[model samples]
Target: MPRRLTRTLRRWLYIGHRWIGIITCLFFAMWFVSGVVMMYVAFPGLSEKERLAALPDMAWEKVRLSPDAAMAAAGAKTFPRDLRLQMLDDEPVYRLTGWDGQRQTISASDGHGIDGVTLDRALAVARHYPGAADVQSIEMVERDQWSVTARYDPFRPLYQIALNDAAGTRLYVSSRTGEIVLDTSATERVWNWLGSIPHWIYPTVLRKDNALWRQVILWLSGICLVVAVSGIWIGILRVRLRRRYSGGRVTPYRGWMAWHHVTGLFAGVFVLTWMFSGWLSVNPGEVFSSRGPSREMLQRYAGHDAPTVAAVVAVTPSSRAVEARFVWLGGAPLMLLANRQGRKLPSIP
Candidate 1:
């Protein structure tokens, strides 16, 4: 190649590499921080203590009442609304609220309650009761559950009450069995509530919908992947151009360019992998929900008949006992369960 053309190519490569690095630094940092947060802080789980503590300060009662009757009596007398009930481990407990809301523990043996707490009150207490600003309207759906769909003030975080009131005195009912599960405020689980911010990235005061933010992140990630690939190509081109320009004479940038070339070449694969995986992490339903392969396909990949598992746990009461299964793939255990719902239970055999 001509010397002028070779020099021009090198200049363009250097410029492209420099700008891509500069522009993507902030995004890379955000991704890194979010990833770390996700690793260290997991989604909320059932806390037996909190649930037990919320029960009315009554003595333990053991009765032979049906689950339906117990749930109905509890809901009508204590709760401000209807409740849901479920028989967990042969004991009927009010699933007043999900992991997302306050829940209750009812003694199945007797109608007496064991414990309960409102999720909103728990979150508020933990988060310093940062009262929502400008609650335009407060609409109560049930006793403990309400939806405040009004515009909140920019100074305060928008609060959604699935169970309990701001004062932490209301009782939330279970949707299934209609029992009063939690009787408290919305002032606990503050960290779990705050942790959702990165997933949405909406400021505490912002009222805008979160769809746009998610789209922006997805688009930026795609661009980053492209930039990473382009950087590798540019590095390769620089190496070739240098070799062609000074056939025998070692270029001044030999060491630096070599370092850049090797690093980019090796790291490109991992970076692209991370980019694609990260992108999927943000929008997993699009890829995993498609009907393409089956458990048989996975079994073939693993060279063994592996138990199929769902990626997410089903929210319904009946599917609570589901667990994930694993199969050996090239001597490494590959998790067959993709989501929390599909997590397998310990092998019975």
Candidate 2:
């Protein structure tokens, strides 16, 4: 390259580096601080432990209807992807999930359809919560800052119930499933404001639409990735082992420029990795392996056979359980019980 052209290129590179560095460095600092908060208290979701704890144990005595009858009521031609017995306002009910992701709840007493949660039913659900206080207020949640992720899409129009607790506990009960989908205590809510919400740009208006939120985060991280890489390169280019024109110096720049250069030199790898990992979180190109279950795995677990209503009715309760699942153990049928406290156990029968 000619000397004049090289000079012009260097000048523009410096300008781009300065402005982009200012913005990207701000993000880098926020990411570092917020990442530590997330390390302990993650954004709230319905974890398995939490779900089990909230469940009302299986009322084996109340199960009068059969699984076959429940399937018939659902009009399912194939074996359901998932089928389990749960208590819906004290009565035994079957929550059947289909391979196509359709969910149907049928009365275990008489095999009638349960459309969704009513206001009274919502209140009842709240009253049954484990650490619940008197229900303060209940509102139908279409979408909100906390429940905007795609995972919550299936539970749209969830019932948000506020509890009169010191932690400002809130429960998101699915209207269709009538199950608690997300639980946020006051501590979790407060910490996430500094943690996940800002780091992921997770405001309701932007996050409600899953695709849009993903793109926004991916591109912003990509920009920061660029800035960090370029900064590392420039820091290297300007580094001097022996003094060029000053008292023994490794960095050519002076003052804030020198501090930015020195600090970035040591922390550049961290900054770069953080931005890259955040970009990977969106799985920009499917570089990482898939998360959770696959369709084939789900089908395999479901198998071809299903439990009959006779067996369901035959189960004698060992203890009060919130839900029960029929499973085959060593060729014999058994009922898996989820106690009110979330313990999983085999039925006495």
Candidate 3:
């Protein structure tokens, strides 16, 4: 009975390995090739340098309202987490951000709140990009393959403008604030089809729903992991390291079968480790969930239970500044200014 049970179990192992290996072989090839492509090109995004370079200098002379008035018009009840004054197209606007991630844009010229950006405004914003050529066409995109990530949620309903420049650059302008949220070149879009898109299993339909995407990755990697383990086990059972085969060979198989058996023995550990690591990437069962700082830990880091910033009445900003930032540091309120070059101007207390 014992010998019969052993033979039955071995047969099942072989069957499991062969079938699962056939199923996951495509995924393995895709991941290996796409991972290499990813090393050269990353997903599309707007860098700080690109954004700053595209912005027109702040026209302080056009400002008829003060920072205090702008904040009040934005309905800010307390000192906001972030406040910045920058140009929106040709007019100056103040962007106020709350601690809970809420944002409001207020016009500095008339102290009125900005409701939404028009198509003409979006086109005007796009023209400011360096080396921008004649406009090819503009399409309204709620969410597409390049802008499917959650980070672009705040800037939904984007205006995708294609420029006729040599680079075939496409710029995404937020319909809410008229800010250029992201830009992608022709080269970036083409390479990413084989790079981050496939490597991350990112498709517009799949990635739009974050929860469903995570589940898909988890299940696919889990099944592939089972294949890796079974392959290693079957390889060990078939390989003969000490005892020679019929022709004094370590593996009884010939041609491709021999190559596979011999290499599987030597490379099994690496393949298993690689497959296991990929499974862990999605943090299955919340095994790798972040243990971020608690309330107590945050207080300890800040050296205080709570730190507050007092709203201060300010004069008109100098003409040299392109942007102004309100921040509280070391329990003191400060106003930092930045020029068009992105250099920090003197801070005012």
Candidate 4:
């Protein structure tokens, strides 16, 4: 190749590489920072005392009911007005809250006079019921404090509910023991908002809505990959051309460019792999689909014995219900269960 043609090609490659880096810089920075925080932060859990303190503040004359009676009162409220009961710590204190509706606090121990109104009923009524609203379970961490969480159908617009109402107010509850740990409505509001800022960037936002912004990021990354690959090819062509003209003697400038070539040659493969993986993480279905095996298939592969197969299968009906079985495989107690299919599963050694 001629000197002028080589110079032109090099100039184009440099421009492409520089632009791609610049475009992805902001998204890359946000992803890096959020990933670091997620690695260290421990999410809060609930307490018992906090769960007990959430009883209704109504007068005895206005509401005179026991803990069981109060639960019955809340339960009778109807659809969109379904009463949710939660326990705090080991004590049986309940947080009475409405879904797609208002919430209240009631004593689970006595079911007496209303403890207090935690959420506004009118606002809860205005909210739409994307699906059935019912509390399946509640956990207590501290006295009068609890974490009340519920899950709706997958096709439902409402995904799940998590409340940490300890003071009978809007708070954050601990997942372990339905106890209020953080006053989320007050001082912690700013931090909660700040935590969500990273969702606007690359992989996070791409997963939610793959619009023009996401496509642009992908295109820029693809360009970078191509530039990296082209850099290696250019280096090889230069070496071959030099050897043809100069009888196999490589110049110092050619050597420096060769180093750049070799670096790009090796690094290009890893870089492409990273980009592709990142893309898959953002657009999962585009790369792979999920399909369940039939009962016959499972029996054929797993085992023909019904009792043996049932023993081997561990069904996690919900996130809260976890089943563990110990099997002595290779003289080691091997614990097995289905994993979050898409991600890498931990090694059992």
Candidate 5:
């Protein structure tokens, strides 16, 4: 390259890195600190242990309708992808999940389908939790900071309830299924404001628009990656390795510039790799594997159609069983049972 062109390019590189670094470094620092906070405090959501602890033991004696009857009420043409009976606010309700990702709740007592949950029903559901005493209904939220992600879309328009306990517990009950889907304590909420909220750039205002959020993340990380690369290049060009500068120092600059040059020389590669990996986290351009299998792909993987409802009803679960999960293996219908202890009983097919 010509001398003038080389100088121009170097000048632009320095200028670009200097300006972009101001913004990206803040984000970089935020990511680093928030990542540490996230090590101990995770974003709030319902875990399996918490869910089980809140559930009242299965009232098998209250179940007057069969699983098949519940499935029929759920409008399942064939066997559902998943079916389980549990207490829904003191009533035995069968929750059915179809292969297409739709969910329905049916009353095992009267075999009536549950279409919507009233505020009274939501409070009842919240009261089932372990520490729920002064349970107060907050407001119906379509999308909020705690439940803004698409994972909660299936349970849209949730009822926010405050337990008013020592933990300052808050519960999000699904208005559609009448189930407590998420619970967060005051501690979790306060910590996550510094943890996942900033790390993932997941403010409710931004994250609610999934496409815009993804684009913003990709652009921000992409620009930061450029800054990292340019900064490394500039650092390499300025440092003297073979023939040392004044005072036998590898870096001629003094003060903060000297410190920056020395540290960048040692940590530049790691910083570059880190930024590159962070940029790749968004999986730009569908380069990595796409999302989970589509509906058609799932159907193909099933290999066979749903099991006949007759076959499903024919098998009887154990007397001690509180929950039953039905699935097909080797094109054969299988029924897996779980007792009150959450221990699996022998499969009955």
Candidate 6:
């Protein structure tokens, strides 16, 4: 190539490197810091153990309706996505979850449907927790700073109950089915201030709208990916390995520029992987499949043979269970008995 043309190309590459680095440096810094916090604290979510622990001991005597009866009450014409038999306010209840954000809770005694988390009902739920002897405050919310993610969208109009506990714990209950969707204590909130909240640029007003939150993250990550790639190229060129100074010194400049170059050398790969993976996380394309069975697969599994109310009215479980949930497999209702240890194999009908 001509010297003049080569000089012009180099100048443009330098411009690209300088501007892109300035544009993406802060986000890269945030990602590095927040990733460490995420490794330790994680985002606030309800673990299965915690959710089960929050409930009162199972009153087996309260379970009059069978698993099949619970499924029937939810109007499961073919097969439901998921079903759980739980105790709500000392009453045996069945929570039926289906695709496309469908949720229903039915009485396990007589199959009466229960809906919505009224303020009074929310207080009743708070009492189920051991530390929550008395409810201090109840906030009727659609979405907030804590519950800003799209995963919380299905459980709209959540009831955030502050339990009077040592940890200053808060429980978020779904108004749709009156189920405890998330639990957060003082420690989680303190750690997450440096974790998920800033890492994902998550805020109530922006994240409550699912479409916007996704777009923001997707586009931001895409831009950052470009910056990281360009930075790698510029670093490779600037790094000298032939001269005396080149053996030890990779960056020619000192101060912030050196900081940028040296840190970029060490951290550039992480920045690239994180940006690319973060974009991939949203899965702008159908690169990966979701864990749940597809609607068609579920329909096929329950094909021709529609589920009927099981004849077994009484259950004589061998082991003690904190709670029992039901699931449909091969068009038959299967009971999942769970205890403090974990869930046992689904009891065959």
The lDDT for every candidate, in the order shown, is 0.44, 0.78, 0.80, 0.38, 0.81, 0.76
After best superposition, candidate 5 residue 318: deviation in angstroms? 9.6
Which is better, 1 or 3, measured by TM-score?
3
**Which has the better lDDT: candidate 1, or candidate 3?**
3
**Native-referenced Cα lDDT, model 6:** 0.76
Worst 10 residues of 5 by lDDT: 309-318
Stretches of candidate 2 off by over 4 Å are 287-289, 301-310, 327-334, 346-349
Q: How do the residues 1-349 of candidate 3 rate in per-residue lDDT, one tens digit apiece?
A: 9999999999988888888888788998999999999999999999877887778877867877677788778777766666787899899898887766777899989988886899888999999888899864478999999999998887789999987789999999999889999999999999999999998899999999999999999898888888877877887788776887887788778999888888887687787788788878778878774766554444344342222334442444554666777665545556777766667754654
Error of 5 at 52 (Å): 1.8
What's the lDDT for residue 242 in model 4? 38
Over the stretch 1-349, how does candidate 1's per-residue lDDT look in tens digits? 5999989987876787678778886767666676666666643332334443333221112224443454454453322121333333234443332222334445546666655334333333222112322222122243211211121111122222333335443333333333323333444334334443454353433414346555776787878887788877765654553455464533235677656666777788888898888788777445557555654554456553322211222233332431222234543433321222323333221
* Prediction 5 TM-score vs. true: 0.90
The model with the greater TM-score, 1 or 4, is 1
lDDT of each residue in 115-205, candidate 4, tens digit only: 3222232113112111213322132222221121222111112112223333122343333223333322322333322333353342323
Badly placed stretches (over 4 Å) of model 5 are 291-304, 307-322, 339-342
TM-score of each: 0.43, 0.90, 0.87, 0.36, 0.90, 0.85
lDDT of each residue in 167-242, candidate 6, tens digit only: 9899998887777888888999998989988898887788777788888888888888887888888888787777
- Candidate 4 local accuracy as lDDT? 0.38
Q: Residue 167 of candidate 5: its Cα lDDT?
A: 96
lDDT of 5 by residue, 1-349 (tens): 5999999999998888888898889998999999999999999999866776677767767778776677767778866667777788788888988877798988988988887989998898888788788999999999999999898888889999999999999999999999889999999999999999999999999999988998999998888888888888898898888899988898888999899878976687888898788778788886998777765665566554553433433234344554666666556556666654557654655
Which has the better TM-score: candidate 1, or candidate 2? 2
Which residue pairs clash in candidate 5? Answer: none
Worst 10 residues of 3 by lDDT: 304-313
The Cα error of candidate 6 at residue 312, in Å, is 2.4
The regions of model 3 sitting more than 4 angstroms off are: 64-68, 77-79, 290-321, 339-346
